[model samples]
Target: MRVIDKFKMFSIGPLVPSAFSDGNDPKDKSFGCELFDKSEKNYHQWLDSRPEGSVVYVSFGSLAVLKKEQEIEILRGLLESERPFLWTRRKGEDEGKKKNLEYDDVIIDEKLGLIVPWCSQMEVLCHKSIGCFVTHCGWNSTMESLVSGVPIVGYPQFSDQTTNAKMLEEVWGIGVRAKEVEGIVKREELKRCLGILMENGEKGEEIKRNVKKWRILALGAVKIGGSSHDNLKKFIEGL
Candidate 1:
């Protein structure tokens, strides 16, 4: 089925809280793989050590299989920014591709960042240490960032990601999109995008303010008397 047809067939009033009830709290639920229990303790330890709003959280959702060059460039950019970061590179997503590259050389400084295969995204976003999100503009990630009050640096890959990036930068004014040259988002662009989002400049401050505004709106939507809550209640009752 075409995308529009699928949407038309299943379009109900936005039933969001069902998908986002615990967005405001990191400890409210586990948003990671239940099988990977060890990472939970490590994540909490890392989060606790960092100061509030000091870390950049980077994830390309679950399906963006980036090329080795792209991954290297992203790492270089993050390193260039000279800020602490938590980056997720899911296992099996880029398995065979990293064979030709030396992982240790790319990730030179252990103190600068933490790179994991998978993580509890919602928990990381809600953490006080997270200052900004470096994302692929996936819908769930975008909404999660919004609810967490974290501004974004969008690195859109394809499909609806471009649309989401546009909405995040142009419509919502809460993020900046990195520009790609010849299908490659260079380290310079990544650094620039992160700078725009993370700096204490006027634009960055404005984005932070906008993020807070969206966060309040998102939390309110899930609260007892909010529109989304009422809509969900009515839908359930009617059923």
Candidate 2:
């Protein structure tokens, strides 16, 4: 069958994939491979210790290698926002001197944040401690954030990411895009975007409310008889 025909046989209807954090899946606790250790703080525990909806989670997906200057600005924005944060830096992202986010040299106070190599993105997004997500607006991350009811600060790097960011900011009303100066999203602009998402002001409240609305709709679509659920079911039957 052609690609479109094959997809026609599959289900990706108006429903979701039952993606959320209910604390039941063993995958949620999995730390991938040897990278996870008991000595490291659990996201759940750490989030619980802090005020609800007070933490910012940032990740730029796996493929993008940021320039050093941009990395520094991102770190500065997170710190200057004065909000506690959880940042996931993938292994080997900073391998070269030219292309990287040099997290090792940046210093964050103990009370300010925690940086990790990788994390369960879904679990973290659904956590009540997550106030907002700073993302490259990858498709999966974008959907997950919407379903998880977490607002976003979109720093789209390239490709489809830019389109997704546009939808998030203008169409969905769930996020604000950070404006870039030259080729970089400067610290001040990042700080301002984060403020728009994290503060209790009108813009932030509207975004939060929009996220919650979409979250409900997304979750509902995953349930039995839901549009997405039925589509998936039909696809499975065809298979």
Model 2 C-alpha lDDT per residue in residues 31-85, reported as the tens digit of each score? 2443332223465676777788889999888777788788789888888889888
Best by TM-score: 1
Can you give the lDDT of residue 133 in candidate 2? 95
For lDDT, the strongest prediction is 1
The residue-by-residue lDDT of candidate 1 on 1-239, one tens digit each, is 99956554332322233445544453464443433323422766777788888888988987888887888888888888898888877754343133222464763444677776677787788788998999999988898788778999998888899999999999988899989899889999988877877779899999999988888777777766777777667667756
lDDT on C-alpha atoms for all candidate structures: 0.76, 0.75
Off by over 4 Å in 1: 1-26, 29-41, 91-104
| Backbone clashes under 3 angstroms, per model | 0, 1
Note the residue pairs that clash in candidate 2.
15-228
RMSD of each: 4.9, 5.1
* TM-score of each predicted structure versus truth: 0.82, 0.81
- Scored by lDDT, model 2 comes in at 0.75
